[model samples]
Target: MSTFGTLFRVTTYGESHCKSVGCIVDGVPPGMELTEADIQPQMTRRRPGQSALSTPRDEKDLVQIQSGTEYGVTLGTPIGMLVRNEDQRPKDYSEMDIYPRPSHADWTYLQKYGVKARSGGGRSSARETIGRVAAGAIAEKYLRLSHNIEIVAFVSSVGPIHLFDPEATPSSDPAFQSLLSTITREKVDSFLPVRCPDTVASGKMADLIAEYRDKKDSIGGTVTCVIRNVPAGLGEPCFDKIEAKLAHAMLSIPATKGFEVGSGFKGTEIPGSKHNDMFVPHPTKPLSLATATNYSGGIQGGITNGENIYFKVAFKSPATISIAQQTASYTGEPGTLEAKGRHDPSVVPRAIPIVEAMAALVVMDMVLQQQSREATREMLGRAARLVPELSRQEEKAAVEGVEKVLEAVEKA
Candidate 1:
């Protein structure tokens, strides 16, 4: 499904090495402030060649808002966006046409569609995520301005260099809550090259990636994402759970292999008595609900429960490696292949923005769906307020013999 969401829907288009890449974002509320300025930073963040950790391909990825806005405000129309592709090197992937790279989508894409783009990994490339990041910026803008919700993602692990202690409380104390609420993208971007928040671990991760890059091999890593200020009842029940949708989004990214939330697989080690979240009165908002423990990752019964929603995304090693490997050709002849292309040694750092973007898309869609419910309740309340308890009209009708029955019935 190239298109995503129901109300705040977005459909991404174009391919890697194509003329342009972008998306059309639909269902933006009218009069909301929007512009390319609000969306470009994310695109830039997701761009490669920002540092030594990523590929050398540097596409400016400047987003151009083609339509659906006037004077820096949304018009409630389909917002058309575009980013032209520069720095194309089709020659870099010419060998891939005959000798399919191992563990890549090239073989599968051909098997499924009978043909595939031989340049720059095509639709299967990480470049495909540009559209997602662009649309996600728009969704994130609305979410932040209207609801005060915030999303942040950072490199959590690169080959077992964990930045966070798994057993430690994700929310340490009131100070942690304060920081969680106040943490900004600026702080995250401050940790460039390897988006890990811990300087020591980040340095180690950077070294490891450098070692891998020097060896012409790729390594896998993980990203941790957090959603803050998510209100209760944001997710649809049953199959379309918020966590499930989040899993879908994370897995949709190129080279992602696994996903987990909260305590994740480790939570199983604890007893039920120890793992269950205890409901308590909110610390700041009296009479409101909260949890003493967030083992549930702020979600229960597939709905958000007014707590921090956090999860981890596991990325697989990049399939294309410069290391010579024995592989079969498209014609079934055995051969040695030297994969040549500008690719990341690790995707975690660059994937941070992509993770943030996908989270924004999911949360924005869920928020819009929840907003419809809020609107319905408000409309019903207004209708009830405008009517008498016995269905009496406020004013009498002028028609003869055929009077308004509601007022007459109430008067009687």
Candidate 2:
């Protein structure tokens, strides 16, 4: 399960206390400008100890690209990126080897593998996500430069503090609709600590995190990610639907407990007639289909409908808490044990980049798949010309289209 994606694949390796944690990204398009600079910012955003509300462990989390590049450009090979675990304190987790922290992966990993890491939960550690963030940075760069696709994610909720009213009117007000259609990553990151876009909500979320941290407890939260400018028909109709893949990518992250996309569960409350996205002509393209209402969240029938794709990821509170708890040990003996380790009070802020990264990966894979499917469809359509069309002009036009398709495939 470490490897993900059909076309553009990423396989992550290493663990929290390992010498390094990194990934090998395959299927990257060649000649993209890629350096440590492009991959570092997301790593920094996802790094621990960024603020008082996060873990106290101060890790630089610097990424080093080992291969798949030539002169700062991608070589169209498996790109290998590494970020050394520079701030691991394995001693703090020594007790976890026997006690098995409640709600953590300790006991599960041990039970599944018949052995576990002496310190953190090895592959289950959040630190492993560094590779995902790094690889997703590459996918994001490619998507942005190639397709003008923009992925933005922010802290949407912390415990009970939500950024928007779930039952409130959505995308109806012209001003509010415009704001959502044109939001940027900068605006999301503008409010720190909690990373919620609303300043008032941000302050409360930050306060909640700090309050929980002081009590040695943790809080859960949600992140909303928006992908804009993705062309229509980027997803498969059935098993590989865009929302399904996004859910798969997001839930793969540690502490993620749930997922929902556009309209989400709230849409269930509305009547089908009202919940449906009415069709409208594209603003500029007369023949193109666009939706008057985007309750579909930019996707329909498991495929992107050329609108903004928005989804929410729910992250459980960091499992490694400092609170003393009574839980059963491996030998089935009940005992009180206190867990020790630098952990986030809430996972939302750091999860922002993780969400964006996973989204980017999903889109990149889907885009490649769409391209492949298009190529095949074009060739098949070209073959269909063998059947009688009854018109010289139509046959001539089909011939020209087939030639053009062949030329493009050769170039690829």
Candidate 3:
């Protein structure tokens, strides 16, 4: 289905070469504040051609809110957002439309849909993610109000280069906030040919990307995302498990080659004795149960455990790099092709915000699910502080009622 989540439904539409692309967010609560400005920064981060490391295609990526609100605040209706495609260069892709780029969805889309758009890979392009990022930003705002959740993603790896310690912890940990403060689109672009985050590794990867660029080729990298302050009990169990939902949301992004949560693949190597998170109850904070180690990555039993939840998604480098390779035309004739288009040598940096956006979408969906259970005592337990003066009034009323019953028994 094009839409995601049962309550916080988001449906994205349009083609890469289409005049416009956008998303419709249904089920947004009324009175929440929203506007184009709230969603624009995310679009800017995901927009291509922002730096040398990203594709050279330039688009203003302006967002316009058409419906779902008046005067900035949500009207409790479906929220609709639009971003016009301004910097499309269809001519550069005219030839590949017939041949289909290797490792791309051109062939698969044709087989499934029977027809395909001849420009910019149409819906398959990363351009489609614009709607997702926009809609996700709204979800983020909703989450910040509902649960105080914050999501961030950064360049964790590029090619063989990674953010590693000179000893064991690395020079600086790749925390989302810390990494974002240091890197910008310009900084990333200046070193875009190689998507490395570490200066030492970036320098080496840069040389490698330039060398490959000279030879007309590309590479791949991985992005790591962290979800912080996600309230416990945000996930549903089993099939709609939080991790399952997160993977589903993330895998939909173009060129996303892999996904893993927490220790992920590494968990396989450790013995059960070493891998399990042992719960330790806090004294003063009786409500808190925490593990000294966070190998579970803040999730247990498919629900958030109020710990930092982190994951890594690997993206194959831009396939449209100017590489002369042997392939066949749509007619099955042998041919030599050199892809010509404005493209990133690597896309891991530009994809940072997209990763954060998807995580926000998932967490927000869970928060809404929790909100729907507000009446349950178990749910109420989580928000005891919200009752304010009503809690004291209830207690006083109970005491008075008890005394009246005792007086009636004595009179009898």
Candidate 4:
């Protein structure tokens, strides 16, 4: 289950306290220009020690491209990458041996595997997302170069403060639509620490995180991601819908509590007439259709509609706080557990790149599957055309069927 995607496969390895953490990415198109530098920016953005709002775990998260490329071009092979774990403190987690931290994976991991990492949460740690971010960077580069796709995610809410209230202002509101259409990473990062984009909201969110950090507590928040210029007809139907795949990928991240697409839960409050997205002629693309409204969130019937795909992911507060809590040990014994670790007071600020990365992986895998189907269909169409006798016979049958239908209607 560590491996993700059917066509564009990514398998990640290594735990939190392991020497290194990385991933092997398969199915990258050949001859594409790629390098470690292209993948490092997002990795650095996801790394810790960025600010006081995040964990002070000093990791450069410097990525090294180990294999599957030469001379800056991808070789259409599995790309191997690694980021060394330079700042691990095993002694900090000695107490984890006795008492499981509340709302953490320590006890469940032990129950599932009959063993757990002595130092940290192991695969359950947020450090596991490093591999995901690295693989996503590669996928994102391919998506950008091939399709001009742009993926941007920012902290939309921290605690009770939101960039805008979804209940009061639906996603169909002009202001929210404008933000989704025009918000860029540069504009998002310009408002640092919280990355909420709105000056007033980001300021308030930062102060709220500071309050939690001071109190030795933690808080949860939401990150909204927008993907643009996605080609239509990318997602699969039934079980593997794009939104379902997106939810799968997103919830796989370390603290994600919920996932919602388009207007999400708020749309439930509106009548169908208002929630519905009406089809209209595309503004720019001739002979194509676009939705007058976007309650569908750029997707209809489990397939993309060549519009912006936006969704929000909610992450729960980090469980490993410095505060003391009443909890139980591995045995049936009551105890007071005071967890120790350099954990983020709030994960939303640093979760921006992680959300964007997961989104890229989902879209990239779906695109590859779609391209393969298209290529196969094109080949079959060519074969069908080469058989002139079969083609003529089929055309005559179609004409006869239409004539019969017309005659039946006239008789009626």
Candidate 5:
């Protein structure tokens, strides 16, 4: 269950307060240039103690490539990586042995496994995401070099404050669409503490997080992610829609409460006529089509349509606050618990990279799966000829024919 993906599989190990936390990334394409340098940047971004907004755990998060590479090139074998735990303090979590912190994984993990880790939240800790970010870096490298795909995530909201007005429809707004197409990680990181791109909103969000931190509490927020240049037809239909896999990957992250793509729930308020994405000819590609609207989030009929894919992930406030709370123990005995640990008052800032990583994982896996399918289809040839393939000229003629018919109807 710890492993994810079908082709580009990743299995992560270790836990908070353990020796180290890392992951084994399998199915990297052979002979591509790879090293710790490519992976370390994201690890650094995801690491704790980066600024006053996050936990002061003081982890360098320096990743080391243990195997599956030679002379800085991946060897088509499982890539092993590790990051040592340097600043662990198991004694800080000694009180958690009896009372499971409210809304934390302690109680449920105990009920499921019968025995839980004596310190920290075990696998539920944000430290476990280091492996995901590392593995994602590798997948991202492959995608970037091969397809020029760009993935970026930024904090879009903190508590009730939003980067855009709550009533504004993001999918229909030209500014939001332009932001999705142009916003980069550099632009995102420049506004630290809160990664919102809007200068004014970022300031407000940071102050809100600081207010909660000073009160020894936590606040929740949302991160909006966009992926550009994803090739068309990269998802399975029925059970494994691209959006479904994306939702699954995102919700797996700790503290993530909800997931939505494109217009998301807002689409439900409009009728089908307004919500539908009308097809238009791609500006640069002769035979390809583009969407006039992206209410479907660049995916239609469960597959990507070569448009920018965007989504929002909602993260709950960190449950392990330093403030004292009245709660019950494993034995159901009432008591006061003052949780001790270094945790972010707001997680969306650091969660940006994690969101990007998970999105990379989902897209990479889907890409590989689609590639395999295409390769097999090519090798087998069209022996059955169930559906005849259309030539480029024929496709163009068909589009012109449709256009002429529509024009005649308009004239009538």
Candidate 6:
């Protein structure tokens, strides 16, 4: 049930402070070039102890392929990977062995599953995001190559600390691919704690984190993501709508409490006429269509209309603050507990890659679905145009492909 997607499905596993946590990618296209190196950067971005703002849990987060790949190429099978839980301090959470952490999933998890892991947050921890970011790297590659699509996500806010202009934000302006090529270990280290591109905001955010750290408190913020160059007409209508799928993906991430596409909540303030995206035929190209406004967020009638797709997500403050809070134990016995051990005072920096990954995952599924449907439609149209001359095999292939596309969409 934790899995998402249709063509390139991914199911995340493991828990915080477990032996390991990872993901299984099902339905990825074969012969795509991939390796641990391809996934390492994203994993590193999500790893802990990278900066003064984050948890002090220093982890290499090294990814190891367990199946479905050979010699760095996908083998048309389920790709299984594991990132070992190194630098873990299980004993730090011993106080909660019988008494669950307040405001965490301890009671709910036990109530639903009858048992819970005592160490750290177990599966509820943000540590689980390692697999998602890794898998999303691959999904991003597929989407880029297949559709010339690119996804960009950045931390737009920290608590009430907002990055004024995105272009002014240092990390906000770089093409992630280009940045990847020039990224050095030294550069990576210097950017850690908070990955704000704007040095001024970064310093301010750093100071704020230090203040919060001293106070043993936490803060929340928002992340903005953009998917560019997506072709018009992806995503099915009704239940399998593209926006619905994206909403599902965003909600799946830990601590994500709010989601809004282009002009989302703001749209509520505008009239329907003002909110509607008016079609504007391109002046230079007759075949191309655009919209004067992107209020629809590059989607209309549950399909992509080929504009920049943008959205924002709000993450609640990390619940695992060091400050003491009052709550009951598993038996509803009230007591005071102060969270200890390594934990991110704020997750904005680490969450950037995770959001990008989820966006990539959704876009990849949409692209594949679009390709299948278009291929089938083209074949059918050709056969209908050349009736009685269509080959038997062509007819059968189109039928099969259409059926597969239908099945996938239905499942989504």
What Cα-based lDDT does every candidate model obtain?
0.88, 0.88, 0.78, 0.93, 0.93, 0.80
lDDT of 3 by residue, 223-247 (tens): 8777776777878988888998999
Ordered by TM-score, highest first, the candidates read 4, 5, 1, 2, 6, 3
lDDT (Cα, 0-100) at 114 in candidate 6: 88
Q: Quote the lDDT for 248 in model 6.
A: 90
The lDDT-based order of candidates, best leading, equals 5, 4, 2, 1, 6, 3
Q: What TM-score do all the candidates reach, one by one?
A: 0.92, 0.91, 0.84, 0.94, 0.92, 0.86
Report the Cα lDDT for candidate 2: 0.88
TM-score of 6: 0.86
- Residue lDDT tens for model 1, 196-290: 87679889999999999999998899988889988899899899899999999999999999999877887777788988988888889978989
Candidate 1: regions farther than 4 A off: 165-182, 386-412
| Number of colliding residue pairs in model 5 | 0
User: By the lDDT metric, which is better: model 1 or model 4?
Assistant: 4
Q: What is the lDDT of residue 379 in candidate 2?
A: 94
Alpha-carbon shift of residue 298 in model 2 (angstroms): 1.2
Deviation of model 5 at 152, angstroms: 0.3
lDDT of 6 by residue, 1-412 (tens): 7788888799999888888989999988999999989888888877887767778888999999889888989999999989999888989887786577766787788888988887878788888888889889999888878777777666667876776543332222345323432433344336556765557767788788778877998888787777887888888889988888888999889889999887777677778876777889966667888887677778888888887787888988888887878877767778888877877778887888898899888888888888899999999998798875657778898999999999999999
Model 2 stretches astray by more than 4 angstroms: 169-176, 380-412
Per residue, candidate 2 scores C-alpha lDDT tens digits across 147-246 of 9999888887899988777566444446445656777878877898778888898999999999999999999999888899999988887898899999
- Per-candidate clashes come to 0, 0, 2, 0, 0, 4
Evaluated with lDDT, which candidate comes out highest?
5
> What does the lDDT read for residue 165 in candidate 2?
70
Best-fitting candidate, scored by TM-score = 4
Error of 1 at 141 (Å): 0.8
lDDT of 4 by residue, 1-412 (tens): 7898888999999898889999999988899999999999999889999998899999999999999999999999999999999999999999998998899998899999999999988999999999999999999999998999999999989999988874674577899999999999999999998899999999999999999999999999999999999999989999899999999999999999999999898888889988898889999999999988898888888899988999999999999998989988889699999888899999998999999999999999999999999999999999988899888889999999999999999999
Q: Candidates 1 and 3: which is better by TM-score?
A: 1
Clashing pairs in 2: none
